[model samples]
Target chain A: MSEELKALDVAVEVDARGTACPGPLLEAKRAIADCPDGGVMCILSSDEGTIIDVQRWSKKMKHEYLGDYEDDGYWRVFMKKTA
Target chain B: MSEEKPNLEEMIKQLTARVDELEENAPGDNLSLGVISGDLDYTIATFIIALGAAAYDMQVDLFFTFWAIASLRDPKKKVKKDFLGKMFGAMLPASSKKLPLSKMQMMGMGPPMIRSVMKMHKAKSLEELMKEAAEFGVRIHVCTMSMDVMGIKKEELIDYPHMDFVGVGSFVDMFQNSKQCWFM
Candidate 1:
């Protein structure tokens, strides 16, 4: 947990690994709400589709996409809630 | 004699006016779904589409009629009914969770097998998709006439927020206003 926090500088971490497709994306959306304005949220997902989905969702929702990193069989995506 | 060049200012003004008029008269971007199948695959498909559209920022209206209304029933709720109605209710799956696949049911083993496979593949289950759809503000509507004909009471359905019990006319109005409509 500390490693992830250090790696992403995220205020909130959503563990959506093992969830499929829209599940991870939905979790990211929900987690972003808990983040303060301009605060970063990190989503950990194993689903391959989430990479593009989160990116698209971030763009559509006007969030700042901080990019993603692959770690230990999962992808960690970072986004800052702009709205 | 050479013809005079078209007036750029006048053409721009006319085009802008036409754009404004189209925007004013554009129908609401809504997706209306006529869900008429109670099979597990169909129910899952309905919710998947609804959730996908809702996530994409499109307003979604799902009208559950005929056999499809069975997918919204609460398994724990038991409604008293006449003998025939009781038999009918008993024959149908109690809730979305109990819905069987349209094909290869294999005496009810297929659904559980498929669900396990979905889980293994990290796919969202029907129940999970339904919850997501609700969170995304998808409007779920139950056909009142179908409920009455099937001897199902309001209490027998899951109490989703903003769920509506309406007649065919209400569904028609929604269909007419929707930019895209599907009967599945």
Candidate 2:
């Protein structure tokens, strides 16, 4: 799943590293608007909660949660805007 | 041909189904918040939950009452007042920036320490969160009774989009319409 996500073409990248709880989520929510419909977006966050927050937020917003991977003490969470 | 009378049983069943569908779809799209604390941490938590719920596209109504109204006071705006009003104004925090933490105050050191850490961690400050909340269309309702008791005038409040001075009954109306009601 991680490799598949890594290989997926992304339309937007939001870097929210070093932010506290909910900060990265807010940033991802704000940045998702820039991603074209059905396009994949990535959020890089150092906050551990961002992984689950992005997933839950995606579920609530009806977006598709692709997957997430850890790199250099940070997480890269991916989602696709689905109308 | 004579028109047949509508079947009472069938009509009742259809009406029941329609009401069920409407009830299912109507109640869960809004959240009502009762903010009664003036502490910085509580205020921040209130906004965090509010903004998060708003992100889900839920309608959010934050009713600020009692001490919470103190945080909404605008420092730059001054109003002439009676003795009691001036005393209340002088004693209360000037704005969101001046609020103290509820715990671990450590002789007035906690607020600044937490604010600095929040900045270092790239978290939104209270002012910034309030701004975002405004942008997200969150409704801010101030309790008129609390305002009157606190001697806070409408002119002294911050200028925010979608803000209103309302009574507790109005807040109860919002609460009744919301899927969840939070008291802070």
Candidate 3:
């Protein structure tokens, strides 16, 4: 999963490292909007809830969920805006 | 002759009709909130729930009555009022920004401390959540009777685009149509 994620060029980066549940997810939603269609967005979050929340939100919003990776006590989630 | 039993086709038709009838009577995908408390924590909790529900595509109706109406006031907008009204308004916080904690306020230190903690955690403030809720199309309804009794003018409240000054009956109608309702 990391290999596949590392290959995709990230069009936008949202640093939500200190944000808690729903905050990271909401920030990702707003950040994804700024990216062009089919563009990739990377979000960094310290909150554990963000991993599942972003996956669920991506599925519900019909976006492409590219998985996540943990580094330096935070998770970095990648998503592609399909719509 | 033996009495005839209903055939498979006839049973299927009856079942389909019953299903249609039930679907017609089902409540709408809406969450109705009765906001009765003006306490800071309670108000924050209310907006959090509303925002969460709205995020999931649920229509949210917030009915503000009595003290809860004070949470909608605009801190910068001052309106002339009678002696009792002025006293009541003065005692209450100007807006969601000035609301004090329900317990251990410590002479107004508690609110600022809590706000700093929220900031440290990167949680959205109550004011920001309220704005997001409005942007998400949550309908904010102010109680007409409460405004009359408290002598609060409509102009004193924040100018929310979708806000409606309504009566108890209107709120009841919305509640009846909601899939879930809460009184906070």
Candidate 4:
């Protein structure tokens, strides 16, 4: 299952590290949609509110909130449209 | 001095139709777009919508004249929502934070409360969105006369790479040669 998933996905890199909450999330949505469906969106934000905003917004928007990762100074959240 | 200027009539027409799309319904379908004149919440929404349109590949040229230029401040800094009721805590689902619509206008109390509620719910800030638009080639033009009239200096705005300082004549000429135009 993991192998099939990996084979049918695309990833977007959104560098919104210095921005405030909504900015990063919105950009992330944009970058994610620019790719094909079944693709993964990685939103990188440094704002204190990024995690919460993405978590809530993605779920509401119907995108699957995969998880969050920390690298260097930013937080990246991944989402994939499941429906 | 004016003699040294090249023929604008010919040059301006060439910039028509193809350089920038002018219609919102049809992305990348307008070379002449609307010029929004003020700085207010609705104005900000207009900017956001324009950016959204451009993100869809539309060519948009926004002229921020008068108070509209004031919105370029640090978006995360302050302000609350308008008549819209506010939301609280990040974990709270946005649906749970729906604005309570009022029927009999609650006097002037609505504005402040809206702001408080928005601050509480945490509406998305506009800074990063503006920056993203600039990166995607959405041209933001600031009016020089309005800046001077409002006592604002050029050095104050954020570092948006595509921002330009142009006058009304430029916008007029550009729009005159365009197929579609609007004023928000």
What digit string (tens of lDDT, one per residue) describes model 1 on residues B59-152?
A: 8999888898888989998878898778878887789889888899999999999999999999899999888888899998777657766877
lDDT of 3 by residue, A1-80 (tens): 88888788999999988755446767886788799899999999875446655665676568888988987888888988
**Model 1: which docking level applies?**
incorrect
Whole-model lDDT per candidate: 0.79, 0.86, 0.82, 0.55
Which stretches of model 4 miss by more than 4 angstroms? A1-83, B1-28, B31-37, B73-123
Q: How far is candidate 2 from the true structure (C-alpha RMSD, Å)?
A: 17.7
List DockQ, one per candidate, in order.
Answer: 0.01, 0.01, 0.01, 0.01
Chain A TM-score from candidate 1: 0.87
Better of 1 and 2 by TM-score: 2
* Candidate 4: tens digits of C-alpha lDDT, residues B1-184: 6764566756777677545444422333434444443323445455577677676676767766654666553333333432321222121112112212233225635434664665687854344456667777877777655654454445555567777665554455446444556666
Every candidate's chain B TM-score:
0.84, 0.91, 0.86, 0.54
Interface RMSD values, listed in order for every candidate:
15.4, 14.8, 16.1, 16.1
Q: lDDT tens string, model 2, B88-151?
A: 9999999999999999888989999999999999999999999999999999988765776788
| Candidate 2 Cα lDDT to native | 0.86
RMSD (Cα, Å) for all candidates, in order, is: 16.6, 17.7, 17.7, 19.0
Query: Worst lDDT window (10 residues) for model 3 chain A?
Result: A47-56
lDDT, candidate 2, residue A70? 90
DockQ of 4: 0.01
Screening candidate 3 with a backbone cut-off below 3 angstroms (N, C-alpha, C), the clashing residue pairs are none
Model 2, C-alpha of A38: deviation from truth (Å): 54
The 10-residue segment of model 2 chain B with minimum total lDDT is B1-10
